[model samples]
Target: MMRPHRGLDPGSVWAQRLRQLEQRLRTKEERIVVLETENALLHLKLAEYQGLAGRSTNEVLQLYAAHGQQMKLQRSSAVTQLHGAIKRLKQDLKSLRSFALELSKDFQRQSKTCLYQVLAAVQGIQLQNEAMQMFQIKAFDLEQCLQEVTERYEKEKQKRKALHNNLIELRGNIRVHCRIRPLLPFDDSAGHSVSQDRRRNFSEKVAYAADDETVLVKCSRPGHASVNKTFQFERVYNDLESQDAVFADVAPLLTSLLDGYNVCIMAYGQTGSGKTYTMLGPQFDGNLAFSIEEESELGIIPRATQEVFRLISEKPPGSYWVEVSVVEVYNNEIFDLLAKDSYGKVFGIKRDVVTTREGKSDVPLLTHETVENASEFLHLVNKGLQLRVTHPTLVHAHSSRSHLVVTLTITTVVFGDNFGTSWEDEQTSQRLNKEASCTFPQKMRDSKSTSSSRASSPVQLEATEKMKQVKTRLQLVDLAGSECVGMSGVTGAALRETSFINRSLSALADVLGAIAEQRSHVPYRNSKLTHLLQDSVGGDAKLLVMLCISPGQKYLTESLQSLGFGTRARQVQRGQVKKKTFPVPSKGK
Candidate 1:
């Protein structure tokens, strides 16, 4: 620390300091010159700034004064414009308030109108609902009235049917309806072969249907005088009459059959007449059975069969059953056409006629096929017809050699109390009463003490109301046409057949004649045909005989004979046709 002054002296330090001062003085002077120069430049810059400030101050003052005056003017104008805008806004607000009030009144008026319309609609709906209710009540009343009217109509229809049945019954049960067949080609040829002068003079019209009930046949004998014979019958059909017209007259008989009456419809005529055609229409080539599609050509039997099933279908189900049996009387012997042998072949079988205690004839061991409808019934009938003995004759191409009889047995079972009390019940009651009234001796009573004790007990009575069975038979007979031996041109067996046919026809005529005379001993046993038709000819059975005659001069004799038979048959009257009702005895009776 003390050695710090050793290097330089104080004096030298002072001298150096003075020298540094002189140099500093000189540098100061030079710096002062520089400062002076800088000052001058500064002064020059300040003077220019002063000049620019003076000019900008003057411009700013002038701009400030002008802006002040403009602001004053704009303030005055803004005050006026604001006052007008406030006045327009107030007017717009007043008009909006008035419009809102008017809109509210209009809304209230519209709301009132909608309310009135809703009320009117509600009232109209209520009126419509009331009217609908009234209409428903009237509709119900009308429906009830219509039902009553329908019931009345049904009752009247039933009454009319009953009266019609009675009227049919009033007419003779054995009725003869005569039918005149049209002239065939053979008849025309035979007539043309005769002298033309005689043909024109002899009147081709040998037979004429005078009226509904009379037929006039003029006998044209070669040697004998011409005798005009008038025959009366229940109904007479001319050649122009259709099968429908013919069946219309016979339809009532079928109704009676459904009513439980035994009915028999027979066709009798000479060869080449229309017996087969009347009972069975023109033979179909391959179709042997009746068809519903062939309604126009349907014969009496087929129509009757359809009608029977139709009437039965109208009744309650399971209340009735129909059975059919077909048989032929050939060579004075009864043969079942539907009979089956042990080989299952339909062969000729002999059948014997048996009489019941009720005076009904039955062919025992005959095949009775139960049928349901018309088709099935006609099928069986056709099968039997196929089995019938038919041969070609000079007079007729397909002539039936045997008499065919189709029997329809209808058994109706009625249940419940509507059948009434049975006769067997009455008989049983009578027997019970008699047993109760019977008196026995004391010793005998002692011997029969057990029996007496059993009798003393309460006897169990049988059911009084029983099922009733009404059995009705509708017999449709197609008798072999009677043939003249000379005209038939037959020999050997054919001759024998003709003889049998004539004999049987004669026997039938005799029976009818006997009935007409009211003979006590009617020879019904003379022939099988008459015996089989005993009920139809004499008993209380409805019968219709269609006596077919050819309206040709060649068959004048046969036509007259057929007309005579019809007249005789129409005269033989039987009692009223009563329905055959029998009480089916209960089991173990």
Candidate 2:
């Protein structure tokens, strides 16, 4: 079509077509460059994204593997714990069921047993109630019978006491009791070697207790036949006798002391023969420190003191007053053992014995301790004993160098039925008026005469009612141990003491010998020992001499001398000791 029109139009159309092709080609080339640059940037970004994605993928895979292993371990542990919990629950359930079954069984058994016990207890209680009623009835009847018997027994006891007292009075008041001490270890060992040959030839047993009241001594001479001598006494205690047995025999004497009678108990013997032991018990062994509960071990002094207080307690209060004095005759001088200075220091003060108008001996300036009970009395006694002069010797370990005398003075006042009037009332008033008149004659003469006349009048008869007072003394004498110089082996001061002791003892023996022989004069002034004991020896006081002896053959001479002394003492008969009773004037009569 263009070929027909063809000429210049064809050429223009062709040129236009060529320009358009070039423009299109250029536009395509610019798009291709932009696309290529974008493609290169996208390739770099994809490479960075691939690298980051590769690292994240590796981290995620590792996390998943570790999480899977952790989950597996947790599941295994949970399974194991669950299995153990189930096993424990099963065991606990079985134990609970068994315990419940056993508890039911125990409850059933206990209920049945309780029912039976309750029934038995009810029956037993009922039986006991009936038995108690019967016992009450029997007890009433027994009490009535006992009341009647006690009345009769009391009447019989009074009669018996009267007869017993009469019997004791009939027995010689000056009674001698002999006691033989047991052979000690020292006694056995003393002359063992020297007497070995003598032991073979001569019998060690020289003295024998013939009976309860007699001692038989046989002389052991090598060339001569044995001469057996028997001595009788009021009571004789063998070596085997205990302190209680000896005290029992002397118990009645204490009763006489409470009956208002003056009593003297003295122990005399050779050294180491138990003279002190008989009166005050053994020394150097704490015998003096014994308690009151140890009654069986108490000696005469303690027992007598306790008994006196017991008897006083039986009486009404304010009826009796007891006073005690402890003194020792050392080196022929009387010393108050309980005497002390204001500073509580014991002083060796000398004492003098004076004879009262009533014929009783009184030591002037003596310490008179007022005691209420046995303990206080014993305390005073211990104070004196501690101050007692004692020294050791070859024969006796604890030898008393003095004579100890413990005196208990009891003043008892008995009230009469008539009150506000006493025998002493008129007498005391008369004496007072008389004394006043003598002092001031002009003023008191008329008053004294009127008072005397009134006192003698019948209106004053009721006022003259008698008030009896009983004053008694109990003397416990612990004589110093008599020793031979050769046997004692003493020297210096001890030897001098021994000589004084022997002389005093000899003087005592002389006095007793004179009394036994019924001499005109008893020679009580021969020594202080005899002079101090004048009333107890020859007066109305009852005297009991305890002659202690050693049973060993080595002490044959001393034992014989002691037996002879006891024999003489027994023969010295004293008058029946009457209880001291006198009318005491009431105060402000």
Candidate 3:
């Protein structure tokens, strides 16, 4: 390959060398272009493979992310379910605990019941035995002794009541009790109170129970000297006192009724001063029966009724019976509330009060209802109260329009055989009064001996056919309020009622005033109310005046007026209460 280019002409050889070098350079360039074309194809294929792998990786990553999210949601749901289950389990556990506690108590009660039953059975078996027979006899003896003790206790109680009445007679004073009512809702009159704060500051209380037997009244006004007055009373009940407490002090007077003495209990006060509330229990709708819860809150009338029946029960069977007469003195006219029509419907009937042969006032042909038990008695009274005149006024929503008088007449039958030998009870009254030698203990012995004799002797039993009847009355009077005309805000018919009420109250005051002044000419006939209350007001009867008052300064004038009335009443000089007896007609007559 070297010899062909070496032997050519010297200039020509250089040209040939140039041509060969050009051909070699062209071949190397063509080879480089082919290699570049293959490399471009390889680059295109590599990019295609890279694009496919990248798309697959992206799909795998998305699926992995979705699976991870699904796992997270499942774990969260499991945790939430666990928590909910725990909460439900906790609630169930609490409920189960309570149930378990109640069940345990129930089981204990059942166990106690079973034990009691077993003991009762065992006691029954023991009682059938001979040794227990002796014990039973001893128990009977003990029971008999207990009964005697109870009888003695009842006698002592009656004696104590008698002593109390005697003491009152000796003192020449009437029992006057003042009761201060708490601030009622209506006390804050809408016309007076501008705001809640002002209500408290407007009228401070002016009257208060200073002690058990004294009332302190403070009269204060703007830019004036306060006038303080103190009044004495037989008893003073504060705003906090319960109805039971008020009745406790008044309960002893009821015993006098069975002792053949008249017991007059009068409730006097201004309108909205709790007179009705003190006389009848709260919410005294008159027609409805009393509820069990309201039993404890019963006022004077209901309690007195119950007391009358209780005392009657202690007497000999069929010895005493009660008859009730209810009358309301309205506009100075008496209306019988227990009057019945042909259809047996009760209504108010106008009646006239006539004077009896003994100068005692009596309502002729007034409706009288005989009751066997306290419930029947209360039912009759409630029926009468329905016919009672009541009107609403500015001072009170249910103001009494008339004076109510509920008289319970207790008829006590005395066997004449008791007067035959040694007994002094309703027997040998003339001798007992002349000698004054027989005492309560002596009377008790005599009654026992007479009872034993009656049990043994047919002669004394036959002599029991002749009996003596004595009737004593228990009068419960609820007086209408002596309120001011302007304060009552009444118009037309109510105004007339107000006038009548005021005049009647004034007449009562006059009677009291006359008695206090020892005037020979008492004005009892001046008003029907005075005439009706003749025996109890100034005669020989136990008179108790309950003065209900409001502590607010707004009712100061009325309070003072009532206080004056009560003071005049206390100063009256009534003689000792005397026993009343009526002769019974023969069986044929």
- On TM-score, the leading prediction is 3
- lDDT of each residue in 503-529, candidate 3, tens digit only: 999999999988888888999888899
Pick by lDDT: which candidate is best? 3
Q: Go through the candidates in order and give each one's C-alpha lDDT.
A: 0.71, 0.70, 0.74
In model 3, the Cα lDDT at residue 300 comes to 93
Off by over 4 Å in 3: 1-166, 190-202, 285-292, 416-465, 581-589
The better-scoring model by TM-score among 2 and 3 is 3
Q: List residue ranges in candidate 2 displaced over 4 A.
A: 1-168, 171-173, 191-203, 283-294, 416-468, 583-589
Give the RMSD in angstroms, all C-alphas superposed, for model 1: 34.5
What is the overall TM-score of model 1 with all chains considered together?
0.61
Q: How many clashes show up per model?
A: 0, 1, 0
Residue-wise C-alpha lDDT for candidate 2, range 1-589, written one tens digit per residue: 1121434443344445445645655665565566556556655665665565565456545654777766556655654664565556456555655655565565556545544554555555567568988999999899988998998888886687557546646654467889987777767545324566654333266777787788988776767987988998877898898888888877777777766678899999988889887876654232335665565666889878888888877755445667777888998888887777889766557887777787665566677666777887887788788888988887778889999999887755433432224423445434434433333223322221121112212112133244335567899999998877877789999999999899999998898888777788888777787878888988878888999988777778888998988888877766576656554443344
How many Å off is the CA of 194 in candidate 2?
4.0
Model 2 clash count equals 1
> Model 1, 1-589: lDDT tens per residue?
0111456543444445445545655654565466556556655665665575566555555655777766556555654664565566556556655655665566566556545655555565578679989999999999999999999998996797567556656755467788887666666444325676655543376888887678888775668898888887767888889889999888877887866678999999998789888998777322435355566777888888889999977765445567778889888888887777787776668887767787766667777766778887787788788888877766787878888898887765543344433422444334433433332223322321121112211112243233345567899999998978876777888888888888888899999898778788888778788877787777767888999988777667778788878878867756566666655443344
Which residue pairs overlap in candidate 1's backbone? none
Give the poorly placed runs of model 1, Cα more than 4 Å off: 1-173, 189-203, 222-225, 284-293, 420-465, 584-589
